[model samples]
Target: MTELGRFGVWVPHTEVTPAQAREIEELGYGALWLGASPGADLPGVAELLDATETLTVATSIVNVWATPAKQVAESFHRLESRYPGRFLLGIGAGHPEITSEYRKPYDVLVEYLDELDAAGVPRERRALAALGPRVLKLAAERTAGPLPYLVTPDHTREARPLIGPNALLAVEHKVVLDADPVRARQTARPRVEFYLDLTNYVTTLRRLGFADADLAKPGSDRLYDGLVAHGSAESVVKQLVRHIDAGADHVALQILDDDSLSTLRALAPLLREIP
Candidate 1:
């Protein structure tokens, strides 16, 4: 299995360019996680891979309902042949609202994995956007491990035991590099609001012990503080470290902002120094 260094950046493929991708590599981020849904062919993944050497590029997830497994596997093979160890395929069963045919997600994901296996996409070369015990176990048994999104260090602590000692637990965390508590929450709330509308996220948050009020629209401040690390770069690094201490093999940092490059560049120095 390819080691996805300790820290990575999660950004939308549409928002990042080849030049920017190269800069991110230079900035020392281990991997670049591209966010995509259905109909995403992942041409940008190839473009980013071509622009940099050594940095691993992974799809945060390719929605199973949006793209056929055969097509995704074909793309994975083509990219793997060209880039070799620099590409990791991250796939997931998206939300019920977004996927009209969303039902029996676990079974569907297993079928997709079967297709990838048939197409020769090695289990070690891929990861799953998994939450909950069943899916997390499946990720460990089938792929690299779960790449859980919008989770706290506590969740990481709980999840590590479920996936066991071998599987890679790459957790995604959102951060805001602002010192002011109000401004930080202001920046973080919008993203939380968006996820609050998604039932899957709400369910996961609830499982993490957040109250119903915390999962409410706009989300409670306590929930925001738990989910997003806001304040100085050092403080944010501390939050990332907590996840690592909780058994996370890698942490994908998602900056809440329109211009992610600036935030990434700003946080790079501090993140690179994380042991």
Candidate 2:
């Protein structure tokens, strides 16, 4: 919790049981990030914190549409009171296609942060789910740094500057531990295709070196490979280091293959020696 040892896991609220949460903590991960589409319940941050003593429980984002700012603030206060300094609130500007009332996303998030601040949610405890410069900049100035999703090391490089040096610029990167380039790409492409259709993600990827064709259906091999980390254990470790070298304070690793327990166990011997 010293703003270091920052590797973490991105999990759905329900996918993680208390037992799994305990295992992740024992694995040496510093935080557990929760992500869900719109209307997904928060899985109760208190439960995650209660289940584990040291590991941080973060929401990759709780959609602003389904959950109101005031309610989120209340939850923040309640959880922080029970377990001080162990919860990080991450909120986002959800996709335009998903919500008809999703107008003025930038303004909405700015206003939301304003409300959160007014409600006494300190800057340190909250973060924005930003994938663009304007929002990323706001994240730096308003609260914690940007939590940019589905990004590459190149994107991490671009975002670090936007968030500046002091803010926590946490980014999520996907990985598939398959040596065959085609097999790895195949495993990772579906994971990225749906995100590509969203203009926010599309633009961010283009910034990181993806082309129009690359963003097409199934995603071009170039886009797929660049966006997702794939290959042997050595190559995967290098890719993670690439993000940290590029300027990430922490990199949340979501290994794309099944057997998450085994992949996580495999990383222990490696992460322990990384520093």
Task: Give all candidates' CA lDDT scores.
Answer: 0.88, 0.80
Instruction: Report lDDT (Cα) of residue 130, candidate 2.
Output: 87
What C-alpha lDDT, on a 0 to 100 scale, does residue 274 get in candidate 2? 69
TM-scores of the models, in the given order? 0.97, 0.95
- Cα lDDT for residue 162, candidate 1: 97
In candidate 2, which residue pairs clash?
A: none
Pairs clashing within candidate 1: none
Q: What is the total number of backbone clashes in candidate 1?
A: 0
Local accuracy of candidate 2 as per-residue lDDT tens digits, 153-216: 8888888887888888888888888889998887876677788778888877787777888888
Model 1 reaches what TM-score against the true structure?
0.97
User: How well does candidate 1 score on lDDT at residue 74?
Assistant: 84
* lDDT value, candidate 1, whole model: 0.88
lDDT of 1 at 157: 95
